[model samples]
Target: MFGLGAYRRWLRSDRVRLGRWGERRARAFLRRRGYRIIARNWRCPAGEVDLVAADPSGPIAFVEVKTRRDEHWAPGQQAVHERKQQHLARVAQWFARRYGLKDRSLRFDVIVVVVPETGRVEVRHYPSAFRPPC
Candidate 1:
């Protein structure tokens, strides 16, 4: 039946599916760059870190992946504004404390992906993308 409930559910699921797909692509890109995958979709009450990876030598990265279809009005990286960065920083702090990684350096990264219905998927990686007040 064409009801609001079904529509809402569909919207939620669609978003989830898209997020997962983007995360998957982001993970691959990080791996190719020699980042060891530490966690995916690490979440806390404050927010979620799409990907947590360890750099080659030291320090950890908290990645945010934004994927959009072709012709997005704005670049994906811009979505992680000051407020969003703060939330993710809080989440990263919680994750570090919880995982005994407080002693290590941490950085915020962003991966912007453009997945067209047909053709190559464009990915842009911005390491040290933002400064978080952690």
Candidate 2:
């Protein structure tokens, strides 16, 4: 029993480490894709945005990154529940108004990072994934 508990704890720790590593990789991937990273791990009273970036197309992108070892429950995109979406949108608005970006075009994006068993990172960027509720 003790051995099993220890193994379980070890597994949990490994998962967290992998998730953090995947987030780092995802940030790098976005930067390489021509997105100018404006903020990382940004926090507001509304909520948190994992990353905020800008594209040449004039849209200030609010990005949420989900990292997992595999797609066990569903794709990482599914993790952004409606409540979460609402909070993100509110936070994005706060971010924009706070920085006088109200006139700028805005978009919500999601990036999913899957770390395979072989330790290869797979990144998927979903542009304009959700819109702010009216």
Candidate 3:
């Protein structure tokens, strides 16, 4: 059996590395899909937005990217629950207002990246994934 320290380190470092790698893949995927990247890891007191971007002549997209070693843990899209969506909405609104985009169209998107232990990467994008809670 392993000690608690090793287990904790695994949780923190390995997972974070995987996540950061996924974010890079997400950015590349977004670029290939023709989304103009505005900001990444955008943060404020309220929360953090993974990516802020825009479609070609379209709405501003507030994107959340989820990365996992595999789908066995859980579907990445399922992780964005109501609470998470609400948090994203709050952050998206803050970004929009700050950037003078309040009058422009807005949307929430989800991008799921799955990296296996030693296999190909999978990326799925869900545009207009959620709407801000009323």
Q: Candidate 1: global Cα-lDDT?
A: 0.89
Question: lDDT at 129 for candidate 1?
Answer: 95
Number of the top lDDT candidate: 3
Model 1 C-alpha lDDT per residue in residues 50-81, reported as the tens digit of each score:
99999887879999999887655888989999
Higher-lDDT candidate among 1 and 3? 3
- My TM-score estimates for the predictions, one after another, are 0.88, 0.86, 0.93
Q: Which scores better on TM-score, 1 or 2?
A: 1
The per-candidate count of clashes, in order, stands at 0, 0, 0
| Decoy 1 TM-score against native | 0.88
Sorting all predicted structures by TM-score, with the top scorer first, yields: 3, 1, 2
Error of 1 at 103 (Å): 2.3
User: Residue-wise lDDT of candidate 3 within 1-134, one digit each (tens)?
Assistant: 87999899988998889888989999999999898999999998889999998888689888899998888968999899999999998898789878999789999999999988888889999999887777
Q: State the number of backbone clashes in model 3.
A: 0
The models' CA-based lDDT, in order, is 0.89, 0.86, 0.90
